[model samples]
Target: MTHRWLHLRLAAPLVAFGDVAIDHVGPTRDFPAASALTGLLANALGLRREETSAHQALQDRLVFGAMVIRPGRLLTDIQNAKLEKKDCGWTTWGQPDVRTGDTYDSPHRRRRDYLADHDCRVVLRLHDLPEGPDLDRLAEVLDRPARPLFIGRKGCLPSAQLFAGWLEGENALEALKAIGLPGRAFWPAEEGGGTVRDISDMRNWRTGLHGGHRRVSEGEIA
Candidate 1:
């Protein structure tokens, strides 16, 4: 079955594909997460943080696969900051996020992982739901986003326009192969054969937590 897919070029000097965090260590995965892509699209559509239902709905509708065009080096960033009861931080929405906890005497510290000089390609298509935005609407908004778009985090901005073009294939894996870029790829396990692995990437937007696992096939795609 031939299906049309939206192509995205996710290239950046520093990109962070989020992984399940423990303590002060925030790690990144080699490929983009389904929740991350869902957030990216929702942000392009100018959806606000309060719209949990919309975010959840969007995530449920996404079906995507990613290819690593450039296997970049891993970079770790050590960060520390001291905060008072009245300290506030700036957010992506251009507003101040006030601290609402007891003052801390010591500086808060954490380590974040990122991919330096990384480049990835993604092919995405929405599930055939009766409601919600379609491929055309998503492409249109990405071209002229309601808000500034970022690759993974607000600090990791894309170097080029994300809308890479469109292609048709039987599934996400075949669509990536159609691009002719050789690299490691990940796609739905049911779509084809590869090393089947369970990945925990989906998020429950309403609860603001990462839960559940999806099976995917990981292998080299030439």
Candidate 2:
């Protein structure tokens, strides 16, 4: 059977390929992770977390590849957020006369790192088309996603459309490179610019592969 590929352009003014946040500092990855990308697809298809079958099928069948076209600048932001108190301590909304300050703090300060002015090309090959939206079906869904799609956070909206186009080919990396939209994204000397690196090992976030790590390359696409 001829292989098929799902191509996507994740463009956003302020995108965050979320890195695990610790000690009030949340850093973002240079590129999107397998888990996060899969989750976004799942979200687009309106698949709930309770549906494990669809999620697992997607993870097992898909071979993920990505090119950081325009490597965005990294910026960290510190802000204070007001969180509603879970208990009765924060009854300011319901009971204006009651005192809630003693119970819970209103705002918490945290630092978040983000990738600004970024555009990336993500391609996926479906080795196995499961019961539901395999890959093509998923792509169709992306064209008119059931829910609004965001980069990492809900607020970080995509500047460009996610569904760029599709391709039919056996080579995942070559197809990605051919379709890759190159730009002047930032890349240090250590990290090769315009080289497509395999990020399968670092796919799942719950399985402890968060901190923007890509391991075991199948060689660079160059």
Candidate 3:
């Protein structure tokens, strides 16, 4: 079935799109992942975490694409954190308070990777579903999200608007050029340049079994 694609822009001073870190370093992908984009859509629609049906239905027929307007700078920061046991009445984490809970002196060295001044044009190709939360509904939500939207992390918000409009043509590259943004057309690749290492699995966003992207090519939208 032919799908109608939506053109949106994900521009933020800083944005991080990656999975939980298995190592000591938390790295961000070059571009946003499909799951992350879907998460943005879900948030715009105000879908709950337990609403797997809504999430899955949207994932079933979706294609994600991106054009690099500003690749941004690769920056990693060293974060010193403590192993704590719950919060202290929203005061802060690891704050000593017998009324709340005892905190541990577990100092953890975490390396957080981020992209400064990152910007990109995201294309969301969604199928026409019947039950609920259709692409048309998503388009409306993007115009005026039920809740305020952010990029990937809460701290990182979009510096510019999110929605561009409906895609004009079928060609992905053409659609991107129509926006008139100046940037390179890069895609997922296994080797060399223009590759995106994504942790979000398009097949299953939760399990991530089919996750771990090798690379992204310009025309190939997975």
> Residue pairs in steric clash, candidate 2?
71-185
lDDT, candidate 1, 65-118, per-residue tens:
999999879999999988899988877778999888988889999999999999
lDDT ranking from best to worst?
A: 1, 3, 2
How well is each residue in 166-185 modelled by candidate 3, as lDDT tens digits?
Answer: 77645454455566767765
Top-TM-score candidate index: 1
| Poorly placed runs, candidate 3 (over 4 Å) | 1-4, 83-102, 186-215, 219-222
TM-score of each: 0.94, 0.73, 0.76
Give each model's whole-structure lDDT: 0.92, 0.68, 0.69
Judging by TM-score, tell me the better candidate of 1 and 2.
1
* Cα displacement (Å) at residue 145, model 1: 0.9
The TM-score between candidate 1 and the true structure equals 0.94
Model 2 TM-score relative to the real fold? 0.73
Reference-based lDDT, residue 147, model 1: 91
lDDT of 1: 0.92
